[model samples]
Target: MTVGYVMLCHTALDRAAQVARFWAEAGCPVVIHVDARVSDKAFASFGRVLGDLANVSFSRRYRCEWGTWSLVAASLAASEQLIARHPEARHVYLASGSCLPLRPAQDLADYLAKRPDTDFIESVTTEEVGWTMGGLDIERFTLRFPFSWKRQRWIFDRYVDLQRRLKIRRRMPAGLVPHLGSQWWCLSRATLKAILEDPERPAIDRFFRRVWIPDESYFQTLVRQHSRKVESRSLTLFKFDYEGKPHIFYDDHLQLLRRSDCFVARKIWPNAERLYRSFLEPQEGVQIRAEPQPGKIDRLFSKAVERRQRGRPGLYMQSRFPRRDHENGKTSSQYSVFQGFAELFDDFPGWLTRATGVGRVHGHLFAPEGVEFAGGERLANGALTADASLRDYNPQAFLTNLIWNTRGERQCFQFGPRDHQGVDWFMATDPNAQISVISGAWSVPLFRSDLPFATVRAEAARLQRIETRYLEILRSMYVKARVRIWTMSDFIENPMEPLQAIVDEISPRAARRLTEPPQMVDLTGFGRFLQNLRNEGMKPTLMGDFPVNGDPRIAAPRGRRPYLVQ
Candidate 1:
């Protein structure tokens, strides 16, 4: 049995596109249903970033208001789109754009192949004990509001309360039982086809169109009434916190996620994009995030300083990477939202090479966070441009710090161009790294910004001519610092271009292995971290499946694991 994907998305197009691309790369056919309320320009932006992929398609726009029937409408539309094109698909996987698949597609499909007739969805009958938290409210199935009742605090809710006080209950249609569960599920094709084709399909659909949060009940009720072969369990994992919404997945949840047996998890946000990216990459061994312990806190710090003092430089690790604003002492965010590329710095040659300059080093920023951050409805391939800096950086000024580190004792060095008319990279090796201006041309500006600020149109395109020099300077600095395999640490969602460009420019030997991409092994080799998914009969992604990491340069150091410094 083959598998297909149906994603329900509202915002964060880049995050959505990244998830879509992950599945597309996994050899699954994907259908997306973006909310109709999204502006055409925003939807178009998603399309533009995704470009022309062979296996991906979008559903017709439908008004998808929260806690309303329109969400189910959008989901139904996506399932239709997937089934219409890929009838051979046995199961239609339903999830949100923010949802991530924990198991490999092949494994999940193989598991489903073993049981072809059963529909997998979470369901609790209205009469079931603890069906709706405190108990199922009668008004949910009886509500007849034309618009989303959640939007107006007074109108529908007050009226519904009045009706309840008067004991006016709308009776459910005979033979139709009310069932509720998560809005997302992986339905069997037979179940989907039956639900879509049932003579009562239209009747049921129209019946729930006025129900509040119909998405949670519509499919649940239909599958229960229609299918005898049904699994009362959802394939998607969720932790509905106190707010009744799935907790947002973040870096800390890596272990929990990897260990989950569920095929999918929901409520992932952009800050966690790097975690998903790492999951997709699959190279750096099992991901295990540990909270800092109180006992070893001061010891770790003193030991690090002592080691550095003794010529045995201790590694400096901080998982909570913040935006550049934090470095300048101006950030209010507890942690930086972008850490995908930063993690690369801790891997293989990244740590092995850059460790050559250990204490107090300042790297340049090409694509920064916040200003040219992974923000907006940026889908994919929305390369960072110079003009984007105008929103944050001075219009007349050029060159802002993207990244820097502590590589030397009492000495801080920064690598960036003096001006961008042309591009070159430089670093101060002494404590005088904070100099106001260069005294001479040995530190000469490679490219002097000459064109009047008025002539600038597309900042990135306008400056594309000299980006080569910018890259060259970066390569030269890496060479000068003797940092091996200088991995680009700026990009998040779109790392291929910058990664390939840097590799092709600096080290051609390592660039070839990236050609074929990563491959997945069968599910029998699944990782042991799946508790949530395993409990549900869902398997983790195929074992031995890893991100592209065969290149000797990117590979973990030959002998032993890098010392832990975090």
Candidate 2:
């Protein structure tokens, strides 16, 4: 016996007619079900196009809505008609209007003839199903969904919530266990007749009328009671994304669909001329009699789902702008943020470039004037301009874009209290940032400036407050960056070790040790600068204890020479 097709059409009646004609010409009886929503003129034209086929017939019209009882009712009516009219048809394949046959119809008939009793339908218990979306699994069976989810979402949600709060649950019809799977299925004639003619069908239908998306579970659950042998898989290749939406096939998916070896695939683009022309036309030569293997393309669909959900790290695009703290990765690659280094050293950027042997070092990128890109270029990588206003508009995007654009190369930039402090918390929370901070180094610039003592003292108080608040953020529990903080007084005592550690972390692959360290600016009168600030009633707390005499580097004279006792 040949296979019979029961197609459910809602839109794109032209394409549906084409597929129906193709199946009817292949000696398979066709039964079509049109949604009542279609215009009368369109329905008449659709019927006229397929009226030449004697085997093709239209079932009773039903107004179908997604996630409601209408779809199940439509399928029931169409399937019953298909079974009665085409009694020679041993198997009934339920497909959608958009489903295109990927293999020859005769090949499918041959495959089914071998396994006459086997019913191909995806059936699994709620506990075993992991692909359910919308937080509804067992609740779908237990809860009552009377309102349309698409049209009356507000009422639907409130009704579901009200039912949940009141703890209302409906009893399932006795002698039947609920099962879930893809709506599409290929059932044997015996099983279809058994499900349609069951004495308790009226009760089962009444119970499932209030169920959510009953079309998926109606046939799937009932088939278990009637079918002697169930394969627990669909002959049709249907795939959904992270969101519960089906993946639509286009012309570009020609090879992808061919590799699946599935008898039919659904949700094809109506305008994909290439896909329709290539798949609808008969495939010649020896046909592969292998079983339908949807798993062959599962990896590609998994990647597509992952890419749609998590997206590429550090990429901020219109399609996917992740919520705060929800990014796959805050930055694309590793980078360095040096605080107080530029203020305490004469030529820190130049020295760092020479030390690393890679000249990817820039001055304060967030300088109030403009972005100080390397070599003072007007535009940086990714066509990022040096406009201060634009950079300040979105400092976080600027930094992320910089790191993303220069992914292969490591980025190094200087930061200080004088520059914009917008990205302080962002850098501290980013795992890719390597921050080296020398506390209270902002006072150095004030000390050497030829300004009045009152002016220096006022500026020192302002900067000291900003730095103190910044240090608190870095020390907080939420910080993810690699942080190394040293008091200015302590860093001056041993600069080589910290420099070596910072350089080593930046370039771990470099086998050589740091032989040439950045030259430190002379701190002859720096100690007096802090003592002077303290004298002005402003406590310089961030900087470690300093000798009030002057420079901490100078050695004190001894009253008598001491001899070592050996």
Candidate 3:
């Protein structure tokens, strides 16, 4: 059986080398995605240790989002390219940037030879409603982010406090719901192809646009939908303490890794040296594949950031709260509706109002701007509106409408039904321009309405000008940083057809050589721009918010941006 190992990577070049070395010894073909933010010098520095093995290849460099589809998209793109490069690749396993092989590659090949048809991915029916990061939402399936927002330091503390004081009950956006699970996945080539060649790919794409972390779900949910037989549990090792962070592999956790019966466990810090050795130690009657011990570096690495809770007297305390757990697995529409406003108004109301020009913005929840009494509607602001649609909408009718709109034949982007209420549909176009206006990361609900189009377009144009001006101001910064790629905040999510048209219109001038020689962040029509640039014999670097895979690439570590120090 032909087996392929897909290594989805971001940082820790030394550890990546160790893992790659282990897999190389197993004779498994390996592909790695090096993040783009890593300096060329740094990548070259690590390349010596990583060495060139016949089985190992590096991905084109790209930056990755923390909890979005970028992660999944990057992986899928890498897998597609990997298969294209090595057609003999058979079983493709999605391993994290920080994963190591527990068994010989040949042993894994033998194991898969026994079940060619069965995909080892974790999958389940939407009916089961199991442990998803966001309950039943497409966001759970489409988005990718290297860092956990819930685990990150208090970037949104005021919102959390406001939520507690208001005792607010949020619901899923109007058309979107959430489904969450483990991000690590393994799959057969057939299943992987089905995902890439899905006839309803547009529908899936739309669905995940609103889903939280499409990276984790894109393959998982699709395999469950298309494949006949699937294992519901992710085969890799993933265990969490009460706080929901994966128990970092410290020396103390070595015994536990041996007994867990898992294929891999994330995320060892680069500092861990001893754990790598322990993984090589032999145990009585334990086959290499079934052995429980960790690699030598596993024990010596410091605790993963996931395990650390930077507590303060009043600022932060790690809690076993449902919200924290659900942040990874589930998010209610009630919560998201409030969260939409929270991310907007609570954190930086002035900046938002100035950008969107919404006067007296208290909390512009996307409650249906219509008069209605039934189906979870309430009279507020002298007009009757629903706080959310799906909350009490007719389920059968609602689901039918959602599915219908999401049909591939439709011209406009159509995400399916809401996993929650009052939010956008399960899949929606990204609010790229509005996101730029608000100076926030890509998120749904920011562009949940058709009404925002004119405003968004206007703001997008203005922002382009502003961005151009900002680029001019930062010319020195760009030069000093040696940045070859520039990411734009000007793109908006919605009706991608027009966006593609825009990309075709302006992609050329945007990529024209800057005075300093760095590539400008191509907006809208980047897909064609990339082609056009290549045709012009100008190999301009791409700085997409999402990941792309081929050859080899490197990304900067999260929180370790060159501009900032921890």
Candidate 4:
């Protein structure tokens, strides 16, 4: 029995892509239904990454107005389509774009296949028990409007406000008590087929047409009523705060995420791209741009700082040579390079020889000052260029050595470029793949403008130029490699002031789609950036460090634990 995951997505293309990518490796065919109200451009952007996959599908754009039947109706329509398209699928797990698999795909599939008789969903009556009003009520579940509420906010705002203030309680008709549970559910084919084919579905649907929030409750009520073996607890994982808002994940939650036994989680912001990359296996075709070119000692050292800081230094470490003599004019030419700096700096010759020339570090040797780099020609502007070079002096090397190895102790490199203009390369075999920039800083400049202007302005412009250059280079690289992410490294560090003009100058040329746009990942605030970005129709990613208060939820406790041998 093959179990598949069906994601009901609405205007969440990037997330859909992420979910699809995660599932692809898990061997599960995915199907997505974008609420019809989503723009064609949004669908196209999602299709660009997911279109090639035979397992994914998009529902015809159907209007899903809030507090309307359209939302529930749309979900039913999409689910039916998925069932028709993939008849062999034994079970259908309905998830939102925000959902992420918590368990390995194999485990979830195995669990589902073993439980063919049971339906995993959350459902319970709230007839006598009062539940939170707005967004998830029975009234809202059955009601469906033609357009999104926000689009008609001007007209709907007064009514919504009035409804909120009135605290009006509508009595449920006889035998139509409200039931509520998790928005996500996984059900067997038999149950889903029965629900879809029910001749009395219209009767139930008609009764809930006046309900407050039907999307969340309608499915739960119907599934519970229909399934013989329904699990009250949702198998998918999510944590909500006391206020009912879903808990947002940050870097601090990494440990918890690793420990989570569920197959997926939800509500991850778009800016969490780095976290996504870290969780996935290293793609055979994906090449990190942070490594130094082989044989280029200067570039190697320059790249070491970024690579080491991130705890993932690359090839450069193999040939690293430390500063043997701090005293002026001490010749290092005879210092054998056979052994790495670990041995050379230890004041001992562990493996030094003259035959292979592998360990010789002769500092006395000097090439002509004007000699150009090897494998590279001079640019039209008369600047020396090289794909590979052995240089004694460079800005990257100088800065890196000063910051990390000034004391001649163990040094590490950063994973990304340390200096602004330190060109990084992404090697892709194709020439026209997609490359996007996914970071923005509208809030920083808007809020911090009152401070000193020149330094802030200069810094913003400098970063923007680097970002622009990165985009340009990425475009070229994508032709060969298919680079899909262009996240802004530092977006929210701007001055508080009017930054409209500055933002306009920094924003990139609009493309056909923004699979990866400039999104602000404000590690400093309670996702203040998310609020602003979403308001502007720009999807932002949440890129904060885990354990904000140094909490170890995302990390291990400092001490060791004893084993239990009962």
Candidate 5:
């Protein structure tokens, strides 16, 4: 279930890098394509942050235009580079770097592994007219325009309405049926390879070159026609306002985002750093698979940062006295391991009490009220009291086959996922799933995702024992780990302001049009030229208001360099 990521981003390298790093650290190979419409300073900085990662790569920039062929071209270019770079990656996840993971990596990985043959793509046939904006599927497929529709979209749409009123129907390319859906997807590598290697791709590319919002239709149509195994769903969650653009995630959307049962969520705005960070951190009952590390002592130990952090308003968890006691004295040396365990197995029953023979506070083990097992099946009947004889309290009987893998020690004890109890141990990848996996000082729970609860639980029982043991030891080395959802103290100053203000900040003389609102011309010499070509029975493979060598109209080779962003 190894995966690769292909991110198409046009702005905010800082935000994009965080997402790239998140996926890269999760062991997925990542390929990024920055829209050539972005500023050079932005592209260069984005490269610096992401290029350092061994698993990350970049495609030559493309001046991707919305609602035009360039966007599809960029996606195909990125796919080629991505699949070539990660030949073994079973799935290639297409996303904007602004997208954030809703579940931990392992959860997504496990979900894909369970359905290894299924492709998570949202594709519906051309007959599904409701998907077309205002049911204008024909307008998107039949029209051929030289200018981008996004700019002056009203002009193109007015023409479309005029055509409908006048009963004008243009013929579509000979044998193709248009399909439309969200562009974001987790495509099977075999399917992607088929797309890249398909002999008819050039012909299909030519037909869609002029289609409005080709990004929405190009891959959807081709993959539907070419592949048989599709789930008709995308792994990324998105919410669109009436205008059809993705809404920005904010502080208030946190809980809604958590319970969405999605692996990724998108349309993250730049200033929404706090929201992004929370997704990266383990939420309650969800232990995000660890990021690669031997902690950076300098950052963790910096007194200045610590003081600053303490002054800021943030969520902090104080461990129960038993773990805190273990964290004191010589035991504190394993603080990361202890912290990892605490965050992961926050409420696993009898863990810190007179159970597992770790540290029995009172002769009787006490669990938090409503403790649950791997399948989210609860066992604890009531509150955590000093009373030794709670109605449903049992020491060893609570959980059998408990195991731990300590950081510094190598010895006899061993445990992993294949163990039947794993389903009850690491709560099936639900942020709400109540089980967790604890190895000595470290513990992790199931990451949240879209898999059915039964599947998740059953799958947990089938995971390799080594995967469990390996991850626990791997995640336990980070000291003071816990769930953190940040909020802006110097807050709520228009999120888009920073994006707009970048012009003045980075390079003032850069092209000003890329940032402008979407619009297109009704009459242009280039538009006429494209229409003339179609009238002449010419089927051009690629068409756009993009510079190919010298002139925007001149045809360019498949892998030529981009002119705008540099």
Candidate 6:
């Protein structure tokens, strides 16, 4: 006993004919159902092309609309014809027009012949099925779906909602529980005949007519009652995406299909000439007779779904720009932001490059004039230009691109109240950011500037206000960055410890004890500067307590002089 194929063809009749001829030439009866939507001229031509094959026949035509009863009717007509016309056929395999045979017809027939009484179909109760889309589970069976979900979505949704609100539910025909699965299945002759010729078939069909996507549920549920043995899986390889849409295989999937070992694979791209040629043409060597294992390639499909949903971290592409706070990672890699470091240290960028053993350090990147790229280049990695107009247009994108482009290298850049503050919150929330802040350090530049006292006072107040607001954001509960804050007075008292900690965090694997420290800009009269600001009616609270004695450094406590050991 051989296997007969019942194909549902809605488009690409030529490809259907090709596959049909392949099966018929292998001694299997083929019954095809073409959708009524096809033009008469096309249907007549399709029929003439296959008219030479006596084993091939066409069933009654039906206008099959997706997610409607017409699809079930078309399948029923085709299945009935396949059973009656081909008495020698032991099993009926359902397939779609786009499906291509991945293995030889004899292999599939031999496989089915081994399990003559076994029906291969995916059958599971609705409660156990987690793959259903559209938020309909058991409700798909209880609620009447008169409107087409695709064509009349508005009415379909409203009708479902109205039924839900009024608590209307339909009763299932006795002895049948709702089951859902893939539409492609292979049923033994006994099960197919029993389901089609059952005495209660009229009642069962009438009830399932209003069930949403009944083609997937009709045979899947009835086979449990009629079949003596069920394999609970399909011989065809069918995969759906996160959105419940089938993944169409193209020419590039040639090797992927061969690895599945499935008898047939569906939803192939119509123009995939390579796939058709490679899969349809029989291989002349010894064929592997292992069972079909679709699970072998499941990892590839899972990764494809993950990449489509949550893209690689910190990548902002035109095709998949994520919403705010919804990114997998705000920035691609870890980087350092030095707030107030440049002002307090002489040649800070150069010193940092040496200390961290990294070469990507730069001056204030968000400076008003232009981006201070490493070595003052006009452009940076990933062709990121130093044009201030473009950088300021989207400061967040500029910074994210910088980190993404310079990945695998630790990037260090200075930031201050003087630079653009647009990216304040972004850096504060990014987990990849390592921010070392010294409050009131912005006043150091003002004091060192040769400007008038009045101008310095006004400028200090503005910078102070910006830094205060920025500090508030850093201290907020939403912050994810690794932060270390020290006031100007506090940092001067003990600076080496904080610097060592920052460097170690940036390059933990290669970090050693700090033997050489960056030279601090002389703060001899810096205390007087703070005292002067306080005396000028502008209180500088962010600087902490400063001694009026003019010296900012506190000498380390010294031990008593050591005497001779004798």
Q: Give the top-scoring candidate (TM-score).
A: 6
Give per-candidate clash totals. 26, 0, 96, 72, 10, 0
lDDT of 5 by residue, 1-566 (tens): 58888999887778888888888888898888998888888787877877779999888788887778887888888889988877778888999967888777777787777777778778887676464665667667765555556677787777777766887655655566777899998888888888889887787788788677888888887787667598887878776543465667776667667656677878877787678878876566865443222122223324434443342121122422223112212111111111122322333223332122232111112233333222243332222233324423432222211112122221111123322232222222112111122321211132223566455444433342434443443345432223111111111112134223422222345434233321111122333433433455542222223222232222345796778875
| Higher-ranked by TM-score: 5 or 6 | 6
TM-score for all models, in order of appearance: 0.49, 0.93, 0.45, 0.45, 0.49, 0.95
Give model 5's TM-score versus the native structure: 0.49
Q: Quantify all predictions' global Cα lDDT against the true fold.
A: 0.53, 0.90, 0.47, 0.50, 0.54, 0.91
- Choose 3 or 6, whichever is better by TM-score: 6
Residues 457-505, model 1: lDDT tens digits = 2232223334334445434534332221222211212335544453343
How many clashes in candidate 5? 10
Worst 10 residues of 2 by lDDT: 549-558
Q: Model 2, clash count?
A: 0
Maximum-lDDT candidate = 6
Q: Of 1 and 5, which scores higher on lDDT? A: 5
Q: Write the per-residue lDDT of candidate 3 for residues 1-566, one digit (tens) a residue.
A: 47777776667777777777777666677888777676788788766666668777777656676665567667877788777777777778878767755555565677777778787765544456444432334323333323445566264344444545776544433333343456777777887887788777777676665455566556766776566578666667655543445655665666556565456677665565666666643334656555333343343323443334422111222462323222221111101111122322223333323333222223332323422221232543324234355423642223223223323221111111112332232111111111112122112222233545445434334433433443343244322211111242222222233233322222333432222211212233333433443464533221234222321112334584467558
Error of 1 at 311 (Å): 44
Poorly placed runs, candidate 3 (over 4 Å): 125-179, 280-566
